[model samples]
Target: MKSEAQTPQPNDLQPEKDEHKDSYNNIETPATDAENSNIIDITALENQMRNLSIGFNLKWLDVNVLPRKVVFEIQHDVQQKILKPLEDVVNTMQTVGLLSMEAQTIFKKMFAMFDGTETEYKFIECLKSADLYVVPREFVISNELRPGVIHNEQGMDNDPITGILMPIKFQLRKYLESPLVFDTILDNLTPSQDGYIRSLVDGTIWQQRRAKIDCNIVIPLNFFFDDFTTKDTVSPHASRTSILGIYYYIPCLPGYILAKLANILVAGYMLSEDRKEYENEDLFSNLVHTLIDLEVNGLTISYNGTDVTVHFMLGFITGDNLGVAGILDLVESARANFYCRMCKRNREQREKDATEYEQTFRTIDGYENDLLLNDVSNTGVHKNSVFNQIPSYHVVLNVYFDLMHDLWEGVCMYGLSHCLNYFIKVKKMFSLNELNCRKNVFVFGSTNSSNIPNDIKDTNIIKSKIKMTASEIKTLITFFPLIIGMLIPEDDPVWSYFCNLLKLCHILMLREIHPKLLDTLKSLVETHHTQYQQLFNDTLKPKHHNIIHYASFILRSGTPRHQWAMRGEGKHRDAKQYSRVNNNNTNLCKSLSIKAGYKFAQNVYNSSFVTPQIDLSNSKILDYPSDITFNSFVAEKIRLLNNSVHFIDSFIKQGSTFSHGTIFYVTYCNIINIFELDCILKDKSNNLILVCSSIMCRRFDEHLQSYEVYKTQVPKLISNIGCYETHTINIHSVNDKLYFRFCNFNVTDKVIESLFVN
Candidate 1:
């Protein structure tokens, strides 16, 4: 990142020396010293004006005013003489551009302005004002050293764990001034707009309110930390790099608009090969030291005759299980007796009795007392967390569990592998080759093509633990029932148990969580765990123990989706790409940090907060026919807009894509109904009218754990619900009959009752 304007020197006034000129052979020109003085050096003069101090420097006229640099000016009559011909060329170039051969003529005419000319300069009077420009500044983080042990080179020689830190205040100030937050707040600051802004406040049941967040601008920040390998895993020269990422969401704008702004990488360091220590207090202390002042004083930004004080508070410290345990100074080994971070349960206690896990929830006072003991065998605490330096943050309350690691990769992989093995070897439903053939032939939609899982290997199946990515596992599980639903028996206990896991996944993936939904999630997790132990005759893994605290975590924090490590892990791709192209392994951390700074500056300059545009070529405007007739209400609605309707095949709005065959739900007369989009109509005012066909909800199938529905030929007319309610569906063909199953969350009993009431 570049710094603010630097102070200029007096020697900068000298003109450049020509290399071709020789003192002995130079010819004396007719121009004298008086004639040469008429020519002004415009570049040097501007530099002198920029660096002049008001009180210290003497002005030419003793007037306290700064000067604005101006280029050559054009006369009024001269501009009008060429205006018509210039307009003609501009109009032609606008219609036919650089792709065509005719653009050469336009370029020739445009270059005439600077063919050959002597430029003139002027200085305009302007008042000097104080402006703010927040730039990224790098700070050094060093490991601890013994007293009287001085290093020759600043911590690089003695401590190989030295890292780079980007101060949080500078990054926060830049974000607050960005169009994402500044423009949105300035545009809608009225009494009626308070409700819309207040919804963006972090108001989870467990979140403590430092100030009235709704009235003031409060930024709730979530910090993510993880380690990723930049080199290929198969290669002998593999290297591991640890990264720290920051994420914040603005309440006024929709969540999807800010998706690209999440997971900003701010700190990183290379992991040493010889370092095997569990705790690093010095590393984290340097990172959070700057945040202490930010939490108390708050950042004040002045612009447009107003000073806005914005507060920064820690929302959550999130990462994978290993990363989270490392930062919190807990036992990093999952196989240890005291493994879980949220509770203190020994292996014997977990295996013998699974109930009352909440009775041993970790608290602040308990953690403090355990720090005094400094024993990892009993309390699982070797040292205190560096994040305790922040005022309102606590390790037990702020650290969140990641579903990408715990459920998708851990529990889901283990359960699915066992079920597949049982189906192949014991039941003799189908051969493994036949199953792989079906998996290869299944057609995934365009949006999901990149997440397709690889072929399942025999070795993985035999071990009862599959190896796959989180994205692949999620995609496969979503359509797993549809792929092999018919092969299994209708009343298989193993298949039913797997469905319970599916229910738990759907609920956890939701962006918003209701109190009623938490009850459903808690029951589903308990039942899923009990079923796993009874069927497999095995004890709970460490991930299973971590899953026990999710409901309690969500009750205090917001949704788990916002705290997952998926986005943090995704950010490693940039670093890997940079490493591949440049092959710079010596100073990898510093190189990645500089690249991140350039990306951040580009995002701010281009104003990436703008909404996505819709392409009109994909749609067509419909013409009204004189022969068609409609009912009174439909005719009146059409007449209100003079029968102007656009029939769109597909279009994007607010980062969501709507197409002809999309499935959504809407409330009509206080009842929710499932509607499959048949066509879309837009009037002159741009309000959408959905022409959809209703799919009747039959019943919530216990065996499939999804809603069994039959698509009806009934057509319905309703307005667009702005995509607030939607669900994922799976299609099945059983004996030449079509079956539809919809997976949804927050399904209250009233919604289920309403579905079957008719």
Candidate 2:
């Protein structure tokens, strides 16, 4: 309700003064007395000139005048060029009803020409040109005059009414400084006030009327005299009658111009008030607290009925800007309060009307008559109207809802909703997936009998299928990871990856896929591969020799020609021909071939073998059992071998035993190492390295059990090794190749630490 002029005072004026004072104090002073003496005393003169400038300008006529001054300057050029034309059009509109299409078009063109441009000088020019007076007066009036009735000898008509009236001409000479004195004298002589006095003395109504008419005649004569001097161009005596005739009747302009000027001033004042309100201490403090709450707690304010309610929600603030939701909520709350108040007032009025009707009719028999009368009084013969039955709460709530929607619509113009919806969907998906996984795990055991078997055959088949399904799910979840990675700040690489995985889980949950199950399988595969690759590269004589060999195998397996070349025999010829025939038969066959390639890669890339220590630990036969325990033997052998010997088999064979032995000795050592046996039988004089083939055959079945467990469990063990944990080597063979590939390099250690420690 406070005017806008009141608002800007504290905000603009005080700050400006303080800034001026600060600038003055901060100004560099002359160092020498001579320099100080030479400095001009301009401060007082500047202040004087500034005050004079403010006084002359109509925009600076009031305390709240910043925007007026700005607008006045900006429209000066347009005003200079178009003010007369616009004024003419306005005057014409007053005389005529509505403008014709052509006249309207011309007016629109003029408005567009002035309004669309941004010239400060033109704005000042416009303000200067608009300073025209339709009628000359003896005194200058303030431009800040409000719309109201003014008394004149002619009559007490409304200020805005337009009609012919005697023209009042006045010279600017005598009354320039004391315009109010002249105005006071004329006001006292006007018919509306002084006519009654004249009537009381004259005793006759006719005499009083003539006196009033005489007083009206004097009003024009006063201005004419002011415009004239003792001697003029034509003599006062010669033009007395003509001047009297001219002064009798002229035109009266509407007072609405003054009213419009007042309205413009009011609007400017309101704007200033708003500015000051923004700078007020109490309001600013409240705003600061509100903003802080919005930032820290995700706090949002809304109105429920007449009361304001605040809401807090957790999660990162999204969209283009922060605190958008909080702002929207505040607006909604205010609107709800407004609607509630309005509804309450309406309900009160309705209840009052109902109570009055009930009080008027006391008896039951008179109720019908009273109801008819009440209906007729209130709604003109309405009988049980639908409006009467409409619930107040329903109407209030509807209005509240509408206002909230509008408020949110404005806030969401920046596209916050799309981002929020996407994030929410992902979060929900993650939650649902986790819930379902827990439920499933509770309902079923770790392994199913129908799918899993007691032997290695069934276990291998089931594990492979599970791994394939998990890989597919992982690939699907990567979409979310990619999006999350894009959203996270580039400076936070660790958190970026963390959020990427979290979002991936969220996306899978939304899709109704069990993320926990997929995540577990992914972890397992990653652990196995990471550990195997590390040990394989670390122990190999040539660091990546094994990996290169694996790549070469893949390249050969991909094409029939390469496969036949690698086979080194004619046995592959028929098989190669058949593969080509199958490829041409169907698109399904080609798809299957691609899938087979991927499966083969997965198997070869993720192969897990037991560490040499575990293999030796399970060995039952040893020549020097006391000296050749599992840990000591494997550890010593690993220490003796080069780090790269596991992958570079030729290097290992060349470095030791093979160089000193014949084909028989080489074959015997290879068999013993491949099969992972300790020499239990002695030949001649502690020749334990050479064992009887029959003894070896006898223990072969027992060795197979240990070998199977070593192959399976060693991979699991190596895959589970910590980064800092020590490992021992085991000799294992695949496809007639003796290799020490497995070493304990656990991947689970880091993953567990990250997930469970904090």
Candidate 3:
């Protein structure tokens, strides 16, 4: 393993000292030795656990460099964090008379999960035998008894290995045997809008892991391509072109994170070639044959000993990989193509009023130089085109629309920038007072900071990424209902339509088709196009901005949200970071695969790390000695002076202020975009306001036995929630009417940490 010192300078984790100065000084706490020491190498720990169970006594470290103390720490953590909880539940079940006779059978299985007896690979073998399979690294349920089920929606499973749930093998078999059970399972985990956003941080390192896992592993034989920019290989070959590549995409994984690497099938590169030749079906089919021996062109994988023998279902190629593969233009390139790859239109419209190109028969046929190699003797031969080589794959649905590229960079950036650009350059509304006002509110909300939030007046990370960042686009999409949308000048109306388009992009993921949304989108596009034509005389539009033509048919497959390639793109970052140097440039293929493999190992070992309640006993050191009031959103924090202590004393006596489950706000920090603090007035004459963070009662999930987390609903993400703000909540904003009781910590000596940046 590469040491910290050995990491490349470009991928260095250490930010320059002066680069970012967080406003809340109390946000960071010194790490305790216990916290630092408890960190475990996932592979070693798994091996340790497996070895420890083989005999009776404590296991010795196989690797000499690893300290005995570290092993003890990991053992303690497993007992305290994992097994002890199970032990307690078992005892409780015994005491309550709920432990069933059928449940009695799973005792060994549950024990095996940790004792190393019942491992993921063992379960995978079972799944393969039962005609069901799962990629263990995906952290999802793996049963294929039903159709239309996408990715795992549960951010936190309800400890699926509990006394109440059936045996793992039984559950898998039941789901595979019954579609109703599968549907019930999906319904149980179907996420709410807020819940989906909350899961964003659970495994953010593997952003869009679920999507990639579903398409690549769960969808079975998904035709995919991964996108990455690598340095040239060793010695004689190293240039921009030599390091870049793509394919029918399911061959690639989503989001370049480790989850994506876990799905990588074939890795290769070459000089420019004929489009048809490069995109041959044989290329992907041969890979499938290798993965699981192809049964008459169908692939079946059997887990060792288990009855699972899952047949892999392969699909047509889909990727955000630039259409530069050059075989055909029938399918629009992910980045610039405005029209839908399935149906040629880029926006919503009537069947009769088809303004876009009609190309449902999406094959390269018109040109004399069509690169399609139609051969009669090929194994997976198609009708006329080489693409038809795959039996079940269809050209229309085969084109998987990438949400990250098409929406984030392509659609959001394209539409938002155009509107903003028009407002700035055309409407001459470059400087909106509302935006500046909100910036003041954002930078220093209820705290005395004469200056705006750091770099708000200067820095443009949004524009720095050539107009905007994916995160910025994400903010606009999510907060369109809450905050960001109001910034658009109402006069244009085009921006409003575009914002709705962005919202639709997000909504499609959370729920299925709603005619209202489709109709609304269609109407918006109709007016947007007319006004757009009026603005530029109906000239050709950027393909990304043509949501008007393709929005309808694309939904026929499912939301683009379900097939985002953001995760695949992120895998490149991990590859670049970990790749060992070979005369300066990293070996792209090997290095990438290695990084991906390590990441998969990490996931396999620590899959449940984020799901459990974080032990914050040492971290939650905060207090509020006195009441605080603010006269203005930009005003300084004020301690109460002889003004009625009634409010404070009353809550203090009730013990409702700082106890568990009491929600509170820490008003000094900024949680802009998702949940911001805007000035509101309950009493016009009062000179005081509360200093708090935004808080809301997170919706309870009986299934997961936890709460649904929403970014807008909870003010945790941007704030230093772990240190200073964890105990605080924000005041109700003017626009958002949702307000719970204000909370304040009992001020102790520990509260001396600076609450705001100077």
Candidate 4:
């Protein structure tokens, strides 16, 4: 285990002030005029300087403090948790062509990691992205309409995504190093007459499943510090606020053009140092070499008279965060002179303006030009000898943009926050002071929301300097556009513009991108820049002024909604909060590793063992009696008038509640299953659901469950939003909770219609 001191960070280059200050000429202020005139200033200024003891000591405050002791400790944890989000992703991937018999999904084994605490994450429950939050509908507010507009008595509550426990690193390493333990497990489980005879004759214990004390897991991690490292003169975040890397002592994980990170981390290199080869090999090469020596490199693992190929395919490395200094050798700032990775967007500004904005979409010729000139320099994949040497590592392909940070934060929140501030504070459309005052008067009444900040004193009441945090902006952007009907006029351009943005998000992030998706996205991007730009600047005085530009990246890269960096950020949020437990700043990395390790393990597990089937010999299935016949449900009220239970029907069937006039979209639905007329009332919860499996049917009487979960997969044309693939129904809430979170086909015909043939 190594502490953070062993890791080197990078320093930021050239502050904005240092770079821009010299560009500005002297202003012609009255003082500047008189000083330049050089007529009445010399003696008069001296006379005016006859002041008292008033002296303002104005120097930048530098509080010296020590850096947080960065370190890594192999938490002696073998157990792990199951993350539902990753499971959902897995299920979808399996449904798609990603997982076949040859490339089977592995690692379904259980390993317990931690005890207690709220480790569950509530997914957005629709479209596609791993960005997570458990926001309640109570936070949504509107006027001239009922409060808690999105709250559906039938909607899902605390809908959880499963997480997995961390694997025993020691056991993994040991098994990979030698096949003795793995062979034993596989051999014992292998169907052979001798094994069966031994189980029956020698010991009945062999019939039962077992898990051995795998190994005392010891992980050998490379803690390299690359010299290309950058540093700062002072940092308040560190305890001793003096000379720190741009990373603030945090090790950069993005750099390894190859792994073993040359493993700069394994070798302890700093960014400040110039480029030099430790062993004439990169990090990836070094890692393979070390693992080869360790004898655990998976190329030799034989089972069933066949070798199991374990070499991972090197998909292109993605740039995360600001991309100032990327982890892998390829990622550079997207806004650099060579701005785009996918196209020739790096051309001069005038040239960019001539081709109807060539920066957003890639033309065949432009892409070809980009390839020829840059040589795929953006990702460094197509460079000479790189692609040919490593066929598995494709260059300039599969590059991603992050939805959560780059799009939602960079553009959506960045732009929308300004719009909201303008409408609420400048236009006086919504009142924060009123919200605060109402909460002050009554804690439990209609005015109070669990989602609202309890201590918020209304920015209107105080002269404030702190801007809204990313989370606050995210909360607004995620739900506000759909629910803004009651807050603003329908004719308002701001509302229309925001709605267009929402439509673009849906088009980009939908399960199967619509055929017209690219074109629709381009139109929206151009409108935002040309049309909405004038409105915001001439009217709103936008804070997030440059958000229009980010739309280009999305159009070119496709949806980054499914990227991992944003999810990592989201998971890191949980860890970051936990690390605040002590003022001592001890084991910040240790605490985060536990959280992140479990998050990672939940996705990667021992595929050798499947989810253990329930032993039918030991347990009996219980069948619950139905309380209500299918006839008991109010037909007209339930919208069963024209509804057919056919497995191949396409029509509208919306949720039962509303979030600001919007409804939960159960539209574009094509049924996949139909049972003999039967509707069961679940115990404790009176949810009425179509009967299926006893296990799935038993949980119907719950609250806040989404109807989409139970629906089987259909053609993308039939249903696109909030859809998940499941053979069985798993509805969690009653009909009332299935609120109108979005619009129906009757309302959003054009958008949803694009999914189908004419």
Highest TM-score: which candidate?
1
Quote model 1's TM-score: 0.72
lDDT per residue (tens digit) for residues 358-443 in model 1 = 77888889998888988888888867788887877777765477889988998788789878888887787988888888888876
The alpha-carbon RMSD values of the candidates against the true structure, listed in the order shown, are: 16.5, 45.8, 22.3, 32.4
Tens-digit per-residue lDDT, 1-758, candidate 4: 77666655565233344322432353333333333335444444332221100000000000012111211111111122234445455567767866542222231111111221112221112101211111211111112223342455543344221111122222233233332334433333322342211111112211121112122221222111112211123434443111101111001111111111111111111111112222112323433343333323333444556655332222223334333123333334444544444443443441223123444544434444544776554322222222213332223333344454555555564456546565666777777665345334432312113333343344523332224444544444434532333456667777667766655455444422332444565676556554445655532111122233334433333233322243233322333343444232332333233333323222222221121121112222223333432223333322442232222111111211111112123323321221122222122221123232111111221111111223322212222222322221112222333222221112222233432222
lDDT: the better of candidates 3 and 4: 3
**Residue 606 shift from truth in candidate 4, angstroms:** 8.7
Whole-model lDDT values for every prediction: 0.59, 0.24, 0.36, 0.31
**Tens-place lDDT digits, model 2, residues 1-758:** 77887677654564333422454456654344333333533454444443333223332222121333344464565456666577577658845855444444444444444442244344334333432111211111112334455564443443221111111111111111122323333333332221211111111222233343322222111000001111132643322211100011100101111111110100000111222223222212232233234323332222222322222111111111111112111111222211111122122233122111213212323323434666332311213212112111011111111111111122111112222222334333233244333323321211121222111122322232212222223322222222232333444433332332333233222211122333342443233233323422322111111111211111211111111111111111222333322322212222222222222222212221111111222223322334333344444443453232221111111111211111111111012222222223222322122111111111211111112212211100111112212211233332343222211111111222211111
Q: Can you give the lDDT of residue 298 in candidate 1?
A: 82
> Candidate 3, which ten residues in sequence have the lowest lDDT sum?
159-168
TM-score of each: 0.72, 0.13, 0.45, 0.42
If the candidates were sorted by their TM-score against the true structure, best first, what order would they fall in?
Answer: 1, 3, 4, 2
Stretches of model 1 off by over 4 angstroms after superposition: 1-136, 143-161, 180-206, 209-215, 233-237, 240-258, 261-279, 302-305, 610-636, 639-645, 666-672, 712-715, 727-740, 743-758
- Best-to-worst order by lDDT is 1, 3, 4, 2
Give the better candidate number (1 or 2) by TM-score.
Answer: 1
Which regions in candidate 3 have their CA more than 4 angstroms from the true location?
A: 1-223, 231-237, 240-285, 291-306, 321-340, 344-388, 430-466, 476-511, 536-551, 580-587, 605-758
